[model samples]
Target: MEQYVGLDVSLKETEICVVDGSGAVLARSRVPTEPERLAVVLGELAPAASVVVLETGGQSSWLHQELTLRAVPAVIVDARRAKAALSCLMNKTDANDAEGLAQLARTGWYREVAAKRPETRIIRSLLLARQQLAKGRRDIENQIRALLRGFGLAVGAVAKQRFETRVRGLLEEIPLLQDAIEPLLAVRRTLLEQSDGLEERIRDVAATSPVCTRLMSVPGVGPITALAFVTAIDDPARFKRSGSVGAYLGLTPRTHQSGETAWSGR
Candidate 1:
């Protein structure tokens, strides 16, 4: 018997419900959300089911990847649309949500979302780590500027290398504060080194990938930004229009409209 499964997943557990082609609930249960548990449960009941519908949450990608590898046909549904479908239901529970998802799947009413590719995830993590290091380096530079300002000493407009050298000399002259600020200078140095290494890796990634290089050609796109954009967007063809890309990046303006009059820029 062919079955359709709907999974309402949270961090700790998932509520699952299986429905037949006739839309009759077959089996409903709660299972641990871990990949192993999910694989086992989905394998045991209705192996290679008709279709499995699951909402897109933080862990949806992980579950989707595991289920796909196990030969389970799963589609990650958009959570907002799923919620709107259940708006009529006054009483909402995980089980109820799971049941609703099953019905939605059976009717083919929900939007299907794509999961991230493995290589994209790896590149995204690396780029994000580099961004964190850059922020930390900025914080250290600001602290040093504030410290110098306290003594009415202004570090002149010099190149980064010369600026650091002058600050080191000034710190050495004031032995009392040298120990405190020297550690910060060391941290700044380490951050600079890490940032440089990350930049080299990002450039290499962009050079090797045709998609990344093409995205870099766009206006306002650099190697770091291009890498982030390429890694996050696994399938550019999915977007029917180029304008959708701006909306995805939150660059599009919001608007409210009525029957005749439309308001702009919300």
Candidate 2:
């Protein structure tokens, strides 16, 4: 008989439940959240049926990748959908949630979301880091500009390459304000340097990736946009229709209707 498995995962521990065909509970256990421990539990309890269901969560992507590597079939369910289904239980508990997930697997009632590739995740993280550094640098520059404004020093239309020079020239005689702003400028320099490093890495990624190279050939599409599009798409062939991408990305018009309320084209 095919066994279905459910795992209610938490930060430190996971509640697991196994059910055989016809929805009979077979075994239940709680184990450390580490993939190795979970894999061992599933191997012993389900053996031939290591396929388990869990809800999407902060750690779901990482856990899915690790479990798949260990030869365990891990299925991620939409958290909202899983919540809606599990909330109907009379008593709410982690163990009950696990059982509910097993039942979901047994009946094939849950929708599966595509797992993100590790490469995509890594590149996306780098992009986010680069964006954060850029924002930080911009904020520092704005703060410096604000300080200069207090002294009636209008840093008017200064190019990026000349921003530091202009600010220093403006404060040449005003050592007090210059001293106050020097630290911020130093921080900005550090942020700018790191941002540039990340940008170079992203450019290298774009240059190495065939898809990113093609994406960059289009006007207005640069390394960041190309990388984001490639990572978001994951697998282009997964979409049956080319136009479906717009809908998938939520760029296309969508309609929502409730009792006496209708909306379209968000």
My TM-score estimates for the predictions, one after another, are 0.75, 0.80
Candidate 1 lDDT over residue span 1-266, tens digit each: 76888999998999998888898999888998887788788778757578999988778887899888877898999898999997766788999888889888888899898898777778887899899999998899889878877777666677766767878777765667776678889999999899999989989988998877888788988888888878767788889999988886789777888899898887
Per-residue alpha-carbon lDDT of candidate 2 for residues 224-256, written as tens digits (9 for 90 to 100): 999999998998887889998998787977799
Tell me each candidate's RMSD, in Å, in order: 3.9, 3.4
CA lDDT of 115 in candidate 2? 82
Which TM-score value belongs to model 2?
Answer: 0.80
Q: Which one wins on TM-score?
A: 2
Candidate 1 matches the true fold with a TM-score of 0.75
Question: lDDT of model 1 at residue 121?
Answer: 78
